[model samples]
Target chain A: MSATVHIADVVKHYGKVEAVKGASFDLAEGEMVALIGHNGAGKTTLMKMMLGLIRPSRGTIAVLGENPAAGEFSARRRLGYLPENVAFDAALTGRETQAFYSRLKREPVKDALALLDVVGLGHAVKRRVDTYSKGMRQRLGLAQALIGRPRVLLLDEPTTGLDPELRQTFYDVIQKLAAEGTTVLLSSHALTELEERAGRVIIMNRGLKVADGTLDELRRIARLPTRIRIKVADLPPSGSPAWLPTATPYRRINGHIVEIDAAPDEKLDLLRRATADGSAVQDLELIPPSLDELYAHFLRQAERPQ
Target chain B: MNALITIAAKEIQQAIRNRWVLAATLLLAGLALSLTFLGSAPTGTVGARALDVVIVSLSSLTIFLIPLIALLISHDAIVGDMERGTMLLLLSYPVARWQVLLGKFLGHLAVLAFATCLGYGAAAVALLITGSSFDGEGFAAFAAMIGSSVLLGAVFVAIGYLVSAVVRDRGTAAGLCIGLWLMLVLIYDMALLGLLVLDQGRNISGGVLSALLLLNPADAYRLFNLTGFANVSLFSGMAGLAASSTLSVQALLTALVLWTLVPLACATLAFSRREL
Candidate 1:
């Protein structure tokens, strides 16, 4: 599949301060990419460049095969953006706001209004935006961004104000869109939330993309030890398990449970040995490096002098 | 073009929903009607036509009130949107930056035109209902006053847009707009008068005086409405200045239009280059 969005050597400078310093990435069609970073890590800046809200000081960005910053960029109709802390006109009703955005996107008003219900805002469609709660406004923002069924959707902190159920519904809608070949790039601080949703993750730190890969790929690169917890059936009151590998260290939680940090290559061997007879181990659980840990690991790797 | 209209329509819808249209219309109508009754009272003694007197009074009112009203509505158009984070989303659409600027300009101008026409039209209608007698010349002058008042409001709206585009926040835009209104409407003419007195006709000639008058949009609007018609100029006691002045009606109107276009262009340029 071709890249729906492309960036190469993108450098954005705000005076002497560089916001995005020489970053390069491409998002393929139907890819759900999470842009995870701390605040001021240039995630929003990169998204704005794709939206053509600001021109990069150097390098080029293409969205839908057109330069987004070009004056006559025709691909804008097929691009949707939800800004951080998304805002709408307080004086307008939710329906009016949706219709306004629909008109701008040259989409049918009926379809756009229907998205309000899809985002679970049907009950408050007629209420003024000022009266709506933060979550409702976020739903309205999401509905607005969904107009025109944009092929490329860029959302910054989209799930900030959403409840758990709404977040589930939000991910369901996004996953459906991605399934239909919509390229999704979202930036958020919620790593755990994105861990299960995003198909791939790009980690940024200090205006640089430090890591980009699937969870397993990043895990392979970082080589952080996997954690394994084993509940033994019959453990001596004072002695450790004889089957425990001597190369890897183990921590005792209590009489029956012990947690061990297994290197990636040794995890399967240890698990097999512990469950070899099916009599010594009552339960076993393996936990890999989470996105949060990977995020910190990558940031630290980027920060270290190499 | 469709995007332009969409943005403009949104602005108009917002103004209506916020009661800006109703409030501006009522304020202008209330003041225009009161001025019509009170200012025309002396017309009976002076033997001046009531409509001509009303035109003069309304022209002066426009010089002060219209700019303030225009600024009040427009000073926050760009900066407020940027601060609220709406402009960032709006610009993400297919619409060009100039389209947003011009679209909002047209929308605010429409709002001002509606208020000016209906508010001042009520006064004219009231005079007719009261059986005030006036010739075709008086009617023409009344129409010109209303037209120029809207034009004058457009000038300030464009100025406010320029301020909005250049300022960092709404508070600074508001402060700058008020300062501009005072400088143009009140302080500009006073300072000019002082300069003329100091010069005592030695350095300033008739040509120079005309240029000076055209420098301020309020003065240009005042000159166009008050002195464009002989009947209104005579009643307002500007006939001598009208005769001596080299500025023509077309020149004054052009000055007002240029006042609007230049700042609007500058605002568009400023806004297009502004980083959201």
Candidate 2:
């Protein structure tokens, strides 16, 4: 598949500080990628570069086959961006704000206003933006970004002020857009929220991209142990099972339940041994490494002295 | 072109909603009506046309009031949007940076023009309603005063944009705009007068004085509307100064136009290079 957004060795320098340091990545069409990073990890800076708000100190960025920072970049109409802590003219009503953006995007005002309903902001269409809550304003921001059916959407900390239900609605809209072949690159500190939705993740720390892959690929690369919990009718007298594999250590949770950490390669062997006879094992549970754990592991790995 | 109009329309809508249009119009109308009645009272005794006196009074008013209004509306144009985080999202669209700056300039200019016409136009209408007699020269001068007033306001608006583009924050821009107003409208003339007094006839020639007057937009505006017409100049006591000075009407207008364009161009250059 063709890359919808390309960044090659892009670096941003604000004086002596390096916001993004020689980072390179390409997002394919219809790919939903989560950019997870800390506060100063260059996430917003990277997104701004993609939107052409700031020029890179080095390298190049091509979005939809055009230089976004060029004076007459024709691809800008096909791009949408929602800034972190998005703001609007307080004097303007929700409908007017939508219409203004629609005109700038050269889209139909009728169609753009329809997005307000999709984002659950139809109820406050006539109200001034200052009267809307933070979440409502965020929804309005999202509505504007959805205008013109942009092929590339860059959202920086989009869900910062959204409630759980609103966040669900936001992701639903994003998923629908992505499924329709829109490339999405969103940055957020909320890892659990993106764990299930994003097909791929890019982890950045201290101005560098530490990891990028699907969840399973990251798991294979990190080699982090999976956890297995066994609930038997009873444990042996010594609180250890005789049939359990001895290579990996096991911890007893209670009289009937015991948990063991199995390496990626040894998970099947450990599971088979635990349920071999079916007489000792009453029930079994398997837990893979979580996004939170993977994020932490990758950050730690990137911080290590090389 | 469409994007430019969209942005400009948004600005006009905001100004209307925020009551900037009403406040500016009301302020100009109130002051103008007062000056028209009070300042034109001596017209009968002085044997000058009532409309000519009104033109002189309103031109002086424009020198002070119009610049302040322009600066007040424009000082925060660029930095304010940047602080509000709207400029980021706005620039992300297909619109160019210069388009944003120029669109806003046009919008604010339109607001200023509307207010100047209606407010100052009210004063002229009041004169006609009061049964004051005036010739075509006086009427033409009155029309020129309103037009030049808007041009003066445009000069300050462009200057405000320059300050807005250069400053890091809104507070700084506000403070700088006030300082600029005081310098150009109040201080520059005082300092120039002092320089002329000190020089007597030793070194500062008429050409140098004309250059100095052209350097400040307020002074250029003052020279244009006050002295450009014979009737208004005779009534305002600027006929002698207008004759002695070598600066022509076209020169003053050119100076005002350059004042608007130079700073506007500088502001666009500055904003295009700005990080956020």
Per-residue accuracy of model 1 over A107-204 as CA lDDT, tens digit each: 99999999999999999999999999988988898899899898999999999868898899889999999999999999998899999989999998
Q: Name every residue pair that clashes in candidate 2.
A: none
Off by over 4 Å in 1: none
lDDT of 2: 0.92
TM-score of each predicted structure versus truth: 0.98, 0.98
Model 2 chain B: worst 10 consecutive residues (lDDT sum): B39-48
Q: Residue B16 in model 2: shift from native, Å? A: 0.3
Relative to the true structure, how large is the alpha-carbon lDDT of every model? 0.92, 0.92
Per-residue lDDT for B1-276 in model 2, tens only?
Answer: 998899899999999999999999999999999999997787778777889888888899898999999999999999999999888889888888999999999999999999999999999999999989868878889888999999999999999999999999999999999999999999999999999999997999899999999999999999988899998798789999999989999999999999999999999999999997
Error of 1 at A48 (Å): 0.1
Off by over 4 Å in 2: none
Q: Lowest-scoring 10 consecutive residues by lDDT in candidate 1 chain A?
A: A239-248
TM-score of 2: 0.98
